[model samples]
Target: MCFSMFRSKSKNSSIIQPGKFTPSNTNINPTALNSPSSRSHSQSKSRSNEFNSKSSSISSRASLSSLKDSLPENPHIYDLSEIRSATSNFLLRPFSSSSSSTSWKCLIDKKQLIVTQRKLRRPIDNSELRRKLSLLCKSHHASLVKLHGASVSGNYLYLVYEFICGANLSDCLRNPRNPNFTVLSNWISRVQIIAGIADGLDYMHNCAGFKNGFIHNHVKSSSIVICEEPALVAKICHFGTAQLCGEVPEAISGEDDDDSSNYHVLKRVGSAVGKFVGTRGYMSPEFQTTGIPTLKSDVFAFGVVLLELLSGEEPMKVHVDSGSGAFRKVSLIETAREAVGSGTGRLRQWVDRRLRDSYPVEVADGLARVALECVLEDPGRRPDMGRVAGWISKYYLESKTWAQNIGLPDEITVSFAPR
Candidate 1:
């Protein structure tokens, strides 16, 4: 499904260090990672070092050669002719978007690749864009799609990424045409997929390149893609909306409310007055009306994704079938909270029916509860990506789907199939 397009972790790799927290930052929004439980703190630190080493290894792979043969224009900027040549006269264009991104499947370095170009819809701070791009390029994690490089070509910014030959999570979860439609419905796969996503967010939030502030800003089912490497690796891909808020508090805490846990905030960096951005169903409520995005805001959107994953329903249009053929719209967040609030009784109402009740009700309830925490109106109350990752990893290791367990790889693009 190339948009003129385009492109996970699984049983074979651990992909997550259970109970460990990584510092979360990406001005797109910030999530806090609590200290690992005392008993496993040392183990968590060891794993963190391993992941940092891997990040350095992947960061070293950005080939300057790719930029050397630049499109006879600005070396930092790509020439339209070069882009056209790489894309075979622009043969694989997916669709056009004035504000949205237009992607293409391209042949580069003798391999299939995904190229995305976006024209700015609103004025974004130039320095913020630079900072975001720098961090974006440095970002390398097993659970995240590798960013090959990016170039400025006229008004549209061009980004190159490794192509994952598969469908996004939304399709795999419910698209009738997806081969994964069956496998993804199981509780094990569901938990693995969500856990894998949390790992990516954990990496982005707590890992390097975001000393400033950065948030995925865009966290949704469509942003998640699953690779069919038997391990069914899931990776987070889109970053067009990602922004870097200049400076923010590393950690904030208050004792006034029960939500006094130390949480990170994703505050506006450059200007207080900025347009709100993000998809409708995925945008955090505060960000929606006031146009402010924080790491907590991104958490809210991620919670929506989890809710969708659990119920197999869109957050905005969720509905239940009526005996008379009429239907009632069900608010995904509110409904999930209510279902989990009931102590797992009638929790079945929120679980996706496609599982046929084969999925574990208990785990389903856990996911709902986690999602409830994420979508809480007070961003401060939302659990940080670190906590979310730990929760998912706990369930992922406990889930029965995986046969072989391996650690997250230094280079996710490396083939993971056993010899």
Candidate 2:
């Protein structure tokens, strides 16, 4: 009977009931499980596990934040369909008739942007194009028009830039309806415009930190816009068009003789197809010959623009000879050289008469001399954009001081009464 009772007890222990707890069957102690000290220990263990989980979650979030910070801010590569939809199937009229490239002012994602269409001069690899776009988009300056993004379709690229509300330097300087009137009426206003442009160019040449130096291939009065309200701010347009459209020649570095020669031939042929469209008076002698744009060429264009700012005249115009009644081309550069060389009051006379003798003669002379230095026939002889910008900045300060001393208002306001 004792042996049978022991067997029954062992069998009952093996068959554990669902809701019944036994210390012999389970590793847990029944007395300790219900004790206050044991319950305290259990609560402590649960709290510690919860604290560790929170810490792990915070650590994971920190790691993810760091990863995001390390990555570059890549520009949006838009789908062709998005561009088409925004542009209403390409039926929108161009923003400006004078623009060499077709551009449309359209809204995308509730933001106004200027979309310029450019034909690709050469095929670019997809990865390589994205890399270049990222670098270009990363560059920013107050005086530069921001390139938001780009879209590609087959052989064309649509570059989107933030639309700035202002008049271009060309129209501001010369009003078609009123030739005698100019929005840049005062000397201080003109100084402000040129100074902003100089600062912007200096940033692109020296400070942009591009692997290959950035070049603003199109630097003309027409390509610069002047924001009149708030302040006279100059913003350069077409910041990365050259690189994006493959207009920048590989021979720009002068690394290979054969490549340079081939680039010249290609540029000459491509000019017919609108691949190369340099402004009439802005092209430097070297740029005209080699068809390769460099930093120095940009300096040359800036010089021309400076002269246009100083003297309210077209870059190139026809002067009819009184003696023979024959038309001959008279370049502003030639007149500027003569005015500076004459050593008389001719420079003062050469300056825009609309200034009404309000500007400081000394400052004007110095600025003209700086412009001349930039237009030297030999690109090697011309000063770099950095040096030129520094000179202009100094002149700008002097002009401001002159304006203040003379009690000339920094800005001119125009109002019209109802006719």
| Top TM-score model | 2
lDDT of 1 at 401: 36
TM-score of each: 0.68, 0.76
- In candidate 2, what residue range of length 10 has the lowest lDDT sum? 1-10
* Model 2 Cα lDDT, one tens digit per residue, 27-118: 76689889899899999999999999999999999999998975434687878887898889889877864545778888888777888888
* Candidate 2 Cα outliers beyond 4 Å, as residue runs: 1-73, 97-99, 252-275, 410-419
Candidate 2 deviation (Cα RMSD): 20.8
The global Cα lDDT (0 to 1) of model 2 is: 0.78
Query: For residues 149-267, what per-residue lDDT tens digits would candidate 1 score against the true structure?
Result: 56554465677676776667777666666533444655666776788788778777777466533567768888787765555567787653454222222233223345455355444
Q: What is the C-alpha lDDT of each candidate?
A: 0.64, 0.78
Candidate 1: stretches off by over 4 Å: 1-77, 88-91, 95-99, 121-132, 176-181, 244-274, 318-329, 401-419
